[model samples]
Target: MPFSTLGLSEPLLKALADLKYSEPTAIQKKAIPVILSGKNLVAAAQTGTGKTASFVLPMLEKLNTERKLRGKRIRALVLTPTRELAVQVEQSIRDYGQYLNLSSMAMYGGTDIEPQRQKLIWGVDIVVATPGRLLDMAHQRALHFDELEVLVLDEADRMLDMGFIEDINKIIERLPLERQNLLFSATISDDVRALSKRTFSNATEISIGNNNASKPKIDQWLITVDKGNKSALLSHLIIEHQWQQALIFIETKHGAAKLVSQLEKRGISAESIHGGRTQAMREQVLNDFKAGKIKFLVATGIASRGLDIGELTRVVNYDLPDQVDDYIHRIGRTGRAGASGEAVSFVAKDNFRNLCAIESRLGHVIKRKEFEGFPVKKVVPLSILNYVPKNKR
Candidate 1:
């Protein structure tokens, strides 16, 4: 259905139209109305399904219609896991709320706190922040949550995985007890449920898909290759497919750097990003990748959650993530916004356990495809294979 029919105001609708959002995604269609009614929510949706807009749009409408907040006290707080995600969420809020008088800013670590403090002094209607940085500001008496009307935990599952649960709990304790809470996650693990129970009262739970479900639009394929030849296989596939832009997922910062260097040696424009890189350099690499200056970006899981690269043609798993949930998020980097995308994984014999775990989480065997140059000669002996269903084997 058209966004106009979703009961959004003319000004907000106009901003969406200007942004070329013709219609709402499934998550938006389902979550927006409930959020507009000022109810607590627990929404689980896949990445790239316009999840950001689902919350941002309704939040804008609510903030615009509600009583305005008095000086500098934040009325809305959005907590994300990483600095990039905080910035992205703030940008979405600003973009959608441009026609409104609402003010917002993003605060995170790895940067000077004085600038964020200065911005907070001027007053903001919404504050998007990482939990650590937010708590720091609150502890320093540079920020207050007394006026918080709405609390949103964007990517709550990731926050839990990153060991931010304690920080999240501390932040929640500082907010008013009667405030509305919204929690969104790609997967609803046991920890997510526990956290939601603590943070949201009588929350309406919305699950768009089964937990850790792969995006249907993504064509997933697995290729078995020698562990030493992963880089070579990746380079071959990129060259074979003639991908315009690809994001390669690796497990470590050092691996990302090595993969980028290898790709560059193959005459491909590549860059790497991880926590080791300065925030400015990370942002620059991301910008260059999005701008098409870099044809390939090798990144650790840090880039998996909130990095939005438009029309990403391929997502290659240079190394399988240790956690099965991460496999879902890594592949989600591509096939976004209803675009067809490809996900290729290079699995080695020794990594069979990881593969089996991923298959178990996906509830089916990921189809195997042998690359022309990279062929599988033998099946790896995975102890987990004994636990697989006969049909799956």
Candidate 2:
């Protein structure tokens, strides 16, 4: 369905056209109407499904139609899990609401707080922030939600997992009792359901796909190699396949840094991003990678949450993630917006358990390919066989 039919303002529709968005995504089709109805909602959809635009569009429409709320307080608040996500959401708001008079800012850690304090004092119509930093602003009286008409939790599951439950509760306590509350997550677990019960009042629930399903457009494959040969295998594949741009995932910040060094030695330019890097460094690296200035971006689990790149066709797992859901999120960096992509993993003996857990959770065995020099020496079966097919063994 077209966004115009969703009751958005002419300005928003114009902005959408400028952004080259011709149709509303599934989540947007279901969510925009619900949000425009001024009711509480709980939404579930996988990554890269236009979840950001779903809420941003409706919220902007509401702001355009409704009379300005009282005070210099925040009227719309969006809580995200990480600094990167906070920045991403704010950018979307700006892009979608450019024609409107709405004002929005992103507040998160790893940046100077004084400027944020000044912006809040000057006033803003919307604020997208991480839970902890928002709470800090609240405690300092730099932000107030007494006039808030809408509250949104993007990636609710990730916020809860990151131990933001208490912060969220505190923030909610300060919001006006009568307001629209929306919770959006990739997966709805028991804990997320319980949180929704506390946060929303008789909210409508909408889900776009199978709760734990991976994107069907992503082609997943794995290569079994020894721990010592993972770096070599990754370098060989990138060089041989002439991979110009790929998002690589590692288990730790140090591992990401090390992988960048190894790839550099192979005459491939790469950059690393992690929690330890300054916000400026992370943004620069991400921008460069997006611009094709850097072909490879090695990141820790920090990138799995809300990183989005245009035409990101390849994701390589130099180190398999321990959590099956994390594995899904990692590869989800590619195959976004209905585009076909490839997810390649380097599975060592130590990652056998992780591989089994992932395949079992996925309910299908990932096809394994062995290269000439990198032979699969040790066939560590899943408890002597589970994810590995009998024919392959």
Candidate 3:
């Protein structure tokens, strides 16, 4: 159904139209109505399923109808796992709430704390923050949630994985007990469920897909090569396929930087973002990539979650992630918003265990193909083979 049928206001519908969001995804359809009802909600949907917009739209609608003053108190608070994700969510709020008069700000580390404190003093209706920075601000008494009407824990699973449960609990304890609480996660494991139960009261729970499920619109491909030749394979695929833009993930910050340097030597426009760089550098690289100024972006797992790029068509795994969940997050970067895309991974002998774990998580074998010039020096593990359909093998 169209967004209009979901009870969003004209301004939000207009914003969605301008943004070309014609219809809601399954998660959006299920979660929006429940969220709009002012009930606590715990939603589990895979990344790239428009989970951001599901909660964002309803929260904007709620804020629009409220008549509260917003000078000293944050009316809505969104907590994210990383600075990049916090900025991304803030951008979505600005884009989707473009027509509204709401004021929003993103608070994260790697920036001057004084400027953020000043922004809070100037006042904002919504605050999107990373747990650490928000905790810092709270300790300094720079922000308060006395008037908070809604609280969102975006990427709840990731926050827990990142060891932010104590900070999250501390933040929650400061908020008024009667406010709406919403928790959204790509995967709702036992820990996530227990956290939700402890925080939410009689919440509506919605699981749109199985945990770590790969997006169907993504055509996943695997190529086996020698460990040292991954860069060659990546460059070959990008040039041969005429890929205009590709988000490439590596295993280390140093690896990301090295790959970008190699790509540049090959006359490719590439950039890298990882924990080693300051937050400003990462933000600038992400902006350039989104604007199509940089065709190739080499990133560590830091870019995996909550990094949304419009019409991103390619995601290459220069190095396989350590966790299957991360593999899903990396591939989910492409094929977003119902768009078809491709995910190609350069697998070496050392990455076999990661590949096997990923295949097992998805309950199927990824399509494996040998590139014309790149010959496989390693064997595809029998475990991965076991998950392959008999006809395909």
Candidate 4:
């Protein structure tokens, strides 16, 4: 449905129109009105489903009116799991609130605290931050949530997975108990449920395909090859497909770096982003990838959740992620917003267990493709789940 029917104000609608966001995604359709009504909400939405806009649009609409802030008080706060996500969500706020008078900032660590402190001198209307950095600001008396009107925990599941529950609780404790609360997650695990129950009061729950088997827009497939020849197979597939841009997921920082070098050696320009790189470098790399300056980006799991790349047509799993959930997120980088996309994986024999888990999660086997000159020396046996040995049985 058109965004105009979603109760968004004219200014927000104008901003969305400027960005050519004509239609609202499923999450936006469900979550926006509830947020506009100032009710507590718990939404289960996956990445790449335009979930960012679901919250940002309504938030800007809610904070549309001006309120004088004290020295270091914020009207709304959004807590994200990663620095990348923090930056991206803040950017979305800015983009959607362009015509409004509200001000916002993305607060995160890995940089000088003094600059962040200085920005807090005159509090922003909205602040998107990571839990640890936000707590640091609060401790140093650079931020005050006493008058905060809205509190949003974006990607709550990921935050819990990264062991940020304590920090999250600490931050939540400092906020006004009467404020509106909103929690959005890709998966509503037991931990996420507990957090919601602890903090939220009769929240309106919205779940859109949280437990679905698969995304039909994404065509997932795999190629079996030896570990040693996986890189060569990736190069072959890229050259054969003539793919202009694709996010390649690897297992480690070192592996990401090695894959970039290997791709460069094959005359394909590429870049890498991981924990080892400085925050500035990671941000710049993300910008380049999004801007199409870098056609191939080799990233570890750090890039899985928060690096928002739009209309990405393809992704390559240089190494399958250990968790089936991660496999879904890695491929989620593509096929966003109902766009047709491709996900290819280089699977070695040793990765059989991971493959089985991923396929089991999808409720089907991934289509297998054999590349010329990339014959499998050790064929991966077909996945046979629920098999118990005679003795065990």
On lDDT, the candidate that comes out on top is 4
Maximum-TM-score candidate = 2
Candidate order, lDDT descending? 4, 2, 3, 1
In model 1, which residue pairs have backbone atoms overlapping below 3 Å?
none
lDDT at 373, model 1? 68
lDDT of candidate 2 at residue 363, scale 0 to 100: 69
User: How many angstroms is residue 57 displaced in model 1 relative to the true structure, after the best TM-score fit?
Assistant: 10
Tell me the whole-model lDDT of each prediction, alpha carbons only.
0.82, 0.84, 0.83, 0.84
lDDT of 4 by residue, 242-328 (tens): 889998988899999899999999999999999898878988988898888999999888644356677889988888888776776
At residue 156, candidate 4 shows an lDDT of: 84
Stretches of candidate 2 above 4 Å error? 1-38, 42-73, 79-112, 122-125, 130-149, 153-179, 183-201, 205-216, 303-305, 383-393
Sliding window of 10 residues with minimal summed lDDT for model 4: 208-217
Weakest ten-residue segment in model 3 by summed lDDT: 301-310
Candidate 4 residue-wise lDDT at 272:
96
Ordering by TM-score: 2, 1, 4, 3
Better of 1 and 3 by TM-score: 1
Candidate 3: C-alpha lDDT? 0.83
Task: Name every residue pair that clashes in candidate 2.
Answer: none
Candidate 3 deviant stretches above 4 angstroms? 1-38, 42-76, 80-111, 118-149, 153-179, 183-201, 205-216, 303-306, 384-393
